[model samples]
Target: MQKILITCEHGGREIPEKYGPYFQAHQPLLETHRGWDIGALELYKKLVAAGADASFFSETSRLLVELNRSLHHPNLFSDITRQTAEVEREAILEAHYHPYRKQVENAIQTFISQKHSVLHLSVHSFTPELNGEIRNADIGLLYDPQRNTEKEFCARWKQEFEKLDTGLKVRFNYPYRGTADGFTTHLRKLFPDEKYGGIELEVNQKFPQGDKKNWEKVQQIIMQSFYAAVK
Candidate 1:
């Protein structure tokens, strides 16, 4: 069955109205990569076009609340300023974070109820170099090793991605290890063992330049690789 679902949490950096001017004041910091996960949304769209049912967060900026990060993560917010007054922060979490999570949960439930095999592809992008250290891998397939389903998916993706472009480096569980926590945590717990499988696909930023053309290329690779893995 051609069943698939996709999502991208750090797709954008849209600041809420109350915090808009404040972020603008610190334009340099707010516009940096820290504010958004650069290029993730575009890749999600590609998956959608390739026949996957894709759900995405529409917040104006990730600076308000990082939809991808665990709600308890300390640095979810860039910094606390007057713009992030107590009331504003509460509202941001209530409106942005909760709704996005609800959407993901609902999608998972709907797919399972329909008796279709589900592949929850969480799309993400990472900077090639962090703290001045170069990241040599082109892609990272994150999956909890304890889960046989995730382990098999990750292994298959690694092989398929390399076949698409042998020069592109592909690794399993590098940069960050996959675990049943954060957004994927919710899905893993909600769905039954055999019906659902989740994979956090992390792409290095060197290829996708946050532009339309480059985004298209990244999207193509993801869709193709995902199709191959599922097969």
Candidate 2:
């Protein structure tokens, strides 16, 4: 049996009460793309409603501690939190990071133990334009190039997207490489390809940042195309 697991790491820009002090002057930054993936939570919710076997999300602002990044990654703790005492940083990880990751890991382990193949979709959004360059794709399906299963599935998904709407450009590993330091990359190390297939679904922020009606339409198309792909 194949099971789907959905995760949205940067779903919201909520600063914890204790850490709110650090972000008092940085509210503007928190509202920006750097703080959270703007439309990721809504998209993830849509996926959950589409009958994912399991789903997990974190609303804690990435600026406090990047949930998608590994502990050792330099960007794990943003500028504000990085300046904290070493013990404080450890406490933050213990409270926010470990629990969320452990929960998802345990869920995947359970599914794998049942001899079920798991397809983990880590949902995220990228700014429409970065560094003055416009990203060329509307949706990006990222997976490790070396993993044939991941590669093949992405190719199929892209084709499905095209069938749904050729106008909606879909690309492979565009905004960011799948092998980079991320939660899905960490899970890939723990779970073998035969058992776990991890793909990061990247949507262009333009849709959510634009007209509400168009955003809703695109989201519905995404859900439909995804269901078609998995089948």
Candidate 3:
């Protein structure tokens, strides 16, 4: 059997009370793409409600500690938190980062033990334009091309999404590499390819940043297309 698991690492831009002081001077940065994936949580919620086997999300601002990034990754701590004391940084990781990733890891382990192949979808959003370059795809399906299961699933998902009349662009591994140092990449090492399929579903911020109704419609189309691909 195949099971679906959803996660949204950069769901919200909420700064914890203890960490508020560190981010006070950088409030504007937190409001930008550096803070969080704006519409990711909303789309994640829709997927969960549409019947994902399990789901997890961190609303804490990535500026505090990026949940999507691995611990040793240089970008795990944003510029603001990087200046904090080492002990305090460890405390932040203990309180926020480790717990969320551990929970998802545990969940995947449990499902694999039950003889199920897990399709782990990590939802994220990208700025429509980054570093003076405009992103061409409306949706990016990221998966390690070397992993056949992950690659095939993304291909099918993209095909299904493109069939919709929504006119949204869908591409594989844009804006960022699927094999990059991220939560999904880390998990791929812990589980065999046959047992785990990790894909990062990246949506362009333009959709959610625009009119509300159209955003909701986009969400519906995404959810519907996923079901079709899964079938």
lDDT of 2 by residue, 123-147 (tens): 9999998999999999999999988
- How much RMSD separates candidate 3 from the native structure? 0.9
RMSD for each of the candidates = 2.5, 0.8, 0.9
Better of 2 and 3 by TM-score: 2
lDDT of each residue in 1-231, candidate 1, tens digit only: 435778888877666676667766666655567767677777777777777765665535666777766767775665744246778777877878888888878777777687776778888888888999888787888877877888888888878777776766788876787873457766777776577787888888867764667656656777798788888
Model 1, which residues run further than 4 Å from truth?
81-83, 210-218
How much lDDT does candidate 1 score?
Answer: 0.74
The estimated TM-scores of all candidates read 0.88, 0.98, 0.98
| Residue 184 alpha-carbon offset, candidate 2, angstroms | 1.0
State the lDDT at 27 in candidate 3: 88
Rank all candidate structures by their TM-score, best first, as comma-separated numbers: 2, 3, 1
What TM-score should be assigned to candidate 2?
0.98
**Which digits, one per residue and each the tens of the lDDT, describe model 3 over residues 142-191?**
99999999999988888888788548888899878999999999999999
Show the colliding residue pairs in model 1. 13-60, 13-61, 13-62, 14-60, 14-61, 15-61
* Model 1 TM-score (2 dp): 0.88
Q: Where's the lowest-lDDT run of ten residues in candidate 3?
A: 158-167
Enumerate clash totals for all models, in the order shown.
6, 0, 0
Cα lDDT computed for each candidate against the true fold: 0.74, 0.93, 0.92
